[model samples]
Target: MDFASLMTKEISKAKPSDTKDKKETGSNNKYQRRADVEAARIAAYNAEQEKLQREREEKAALKRKHEEDELERRREREEKKRKLAEESRKKREAEEEAAERQRRKRLGLPELPPRASEEGTPVPEEEDIDDEELIKKLRELNEPATLFAETHKARLKRYRKLVKRSLTPQLSNGPIPTTLELVPEKDMKIPAKIPKDIDPESRKFLFRQLASYFTMLLEEWAIALAKRDTSVKESFSGRQAFNAMVQSRDNMRPLFKKFETGDIDHTVLEAIVEIVHCAQERRYVDANDGYLRLSIGKAAWPIGVTMVGIHERSAREKLHESDNKAHIMSDEVTRKYLQSIKRCLSFAQVRWPPDDLLQLMG
Candidate 1:
C-alpha cells in the first residue's frame, strides 16, 4: 500500500471516533439539563404545596379563633341574662311580700312578726317549760333532748333551732342521722369486760337516746292497753307493794316471767301495761286477798309508805321536812335493785303506736 492511502484510512477512523465522542457529550449535556429542570420543578412543587398547607392552617386557626370568640361572647351574654333574671326575681319577690303585708293589714289578720335583730334573736333562758312538751319537741326534731350536757339556756336555744328547722321541709323530713351502738352480747366468760378504748361519752350519749326510746315503748304499751281495754285511765304511778301484789296474782306469772327472762316482746309488754293499768285502778287487790290470814308472798312487803324518802343528815335533808311516814329502802339489796332498774331504763327499743311496736317488740 501507498503511505498516503494508509494515512487517509487512519484519519477517517479517527474522525468517526471523535464524532461519536462529541455526540455522547451532547447527549450527556441534554440529560443533565433535563435533570436540572426536573429538580427545579420538584422544588417549586414542594414550595407550592407547603404554601397551600400554610394557608389551610392559617384559615383553620382563624376559624377556631372566631369560634372561641363566639363561645366567650355567648357565655358572657348568658351570664348577663342570668344576673338580670335574678335581679328581676328579687324585685318580684319584694313586691309580693309588700303586697302580702298590706293585705294582712287590711284583713285585720295578725301581721308577720318583726324581723329579728341583725345579730339574731336571743332565745329565752327559761327552764320552766313543761318537760313533756320540750321532750316531745325534741323527739319530733329527731334530736336527743339530753344529747349534750348543756345549760337550760343552751337547751332552749336548741329547741329554737328545732323550731326553725321544722319550718324547712327538707331539714324536717331529713332527720339528723344518728348511729346506733350495737350492744355487745352478754357473755358468761370471766365476767365480760367492756373495752376501755370504747368512748365512754359516746356510750353515755347512746344510752341517753335509748332511754327516750324506752319511754316511747312504755307509752306505746299504754296505748295498746287502751285499745285492748278501754276501761283504764292513763295515770302515772310508782309503788313498792305492787311487786308483792304482782307475784301473788296467779295470772301475773306469765307476764312477770317474760320480764325475768329479759325477753321484751310486744305481747309481754302489752300484758304488763294491762296489769299496771288494772293495779292503778285497784282492780287486782279487790279481786284477790280473800282473807287476812293469807299472806301473799312472805307476809306481803310493807305497804302504805311513801318511797324516795330523804335520809337523815344528807344533802337533801334540808330539802324535806322530818316525816316518819316517809319510807326508804337503803339496804344493799335495794341498791342493787336500783342499779338493775337503771340499766333497764337505759335499754329500751322504740316501737310505738302498739301495732307498729308489736311488729318490733323483741
Candidate 2:
C-alpha cells in the first residue's frame, strides 16, 4: 500500500510541469511565424519594384534606338540626294562639251590646245578674220565698185534725168538726145594693135590729158546748166548744188573718174560749182555773198595745160573755201552735202576710165 501511493503522487506532479513547458514552447513558435510572414512581404515588394525599374530601362532604350534609326535614315536620304545631284551636274557638263565639239567639227574649226597655265591664258587656236580687215580687203579688190556700176547704171541714168528735170529750164526745143550710150559686152570692139612705143610715162601723160579734157567738158556742162536755169541764182544751197551735180551722169562721171585716180582737176572745180549752184537753188546757202559763188571753168582751165596734179593748190583752196562756206548753212543742208560728197568720192575712188579713147572721152 505505501509504495503505490508514493508513485502516483510523483507522476501527477511531473504531468503538471510538462504541461507548462509545452505552453511556453507554443507561444515562442507563434512569434517566429509572424516574423517570417513580414520578411516574405518585404521581399515581394522589393522584387516588384526591381521589375518595374527594369521595364522602364528597356522602354527608354527602345525609344533611344528609334530616334537613332530616324536620324540615320534622314542622313542616308540626304547623302543619296547629294550624290544624285553631283552625278547630274557631271552628266550635263559632259553633254555640253560634246555639243561644243560637234559644232567645232561642223565649222571645220581646229581643236584648241590646252593652256599650260589654266588661269587667264587663252587657248592656242586660229581666229576668224575681223570684220574691218575683211572690209578693207574687199575695198582693195574694188569688186564692190565694179558690181555697183554694172548693176546700177540704169539707176544712174534715171538720176541723171531727174537732175536735168530739176536743173534745166523748159526750152522751146525738145530735150536733146544723150551723146553717151552704154555699150553692151557683145558690141565692145577689141583693139586691133598694141602700142609698143608708148612708155609708162607717156601713157600716164596721155591718160592725165584725157582726164583733163573730160574735166574741161564737164565744167562747160555745169556752166551751161547754171545759165539755163535762172532759179539757181534765185535760190541756192550747198547741199542742193552738190545733190544736183551728183544726180547728173554726165557731170558726175568725170568727177567720179578723177576721184578714182586721186586727181582733182578743173572738172572737180566745175563739179563743186554745180554743187554750190544746186545748194543756192535750194536756199541752203544764206551767206551775204549770194550763196558762195565758185567758177568751175576758170578754176579748171589751168589744169589742162600745166600737166600738174589735178589736186593743185588752186583746186584744194577752192574746195576748202567752198566746204567752209557750206558748213554755215542749215544742219540738214550740211548733212546732205557731206553725204553726197562721200557718195561721189566713194564712186570716184573705184571708177576707171574706159580702155577705148571714145569711151573714155564719153
Indicate which candidate wins on lDDT.
2
For model 1, how many clashes? Answer: 0
Q: Write one digit per residue (lDDT tens) for candidate 2, span 124-238.
A: 3453334455445445544332234443333334444554665763321102122222223233222222255767564344343333433333344455456645665456664
Q: Would you give me the overall lDDT of model 2?
A: 0.47
Error of 2 at 156 (Å): 68
In model 1, which runs have C-alpha deviations exceeding 4 angstroms? Answer: 1-21, 32-49, 104-362
- Each prediction's TM-score versus the true structure: 0.27, 0.26
The deviation in Å at residue 9 for candidate 1 is: 10
The stretch of ten residues in a row with the least summed lDDT in candidate 2 is 171-180
Q: Write the per-residue lDDT of candidate 1 for residues 1-362, one digit (tens) a residue.
A: 99999999999989988999999998977666768889999999999999999999999999999999999999999999999999998799778878889999999999867546557555555634665777787887788876567765567668977788767533111111122222322211111122446485643433333333333333444443445332233333323323322222323233223333444433223332333232223344321221111111122233355345565433433334332111113244323322332222222222211333222222
Q: After superposition, how far is residue 119 of candidate 1 from its true place, in Å?
A: 14
Candidate 2 segments exceeding 4 Å error: 1-7, 32-40, 108-362
Candidate 1 clashing pairs, residues 3+ apart or interchain = none
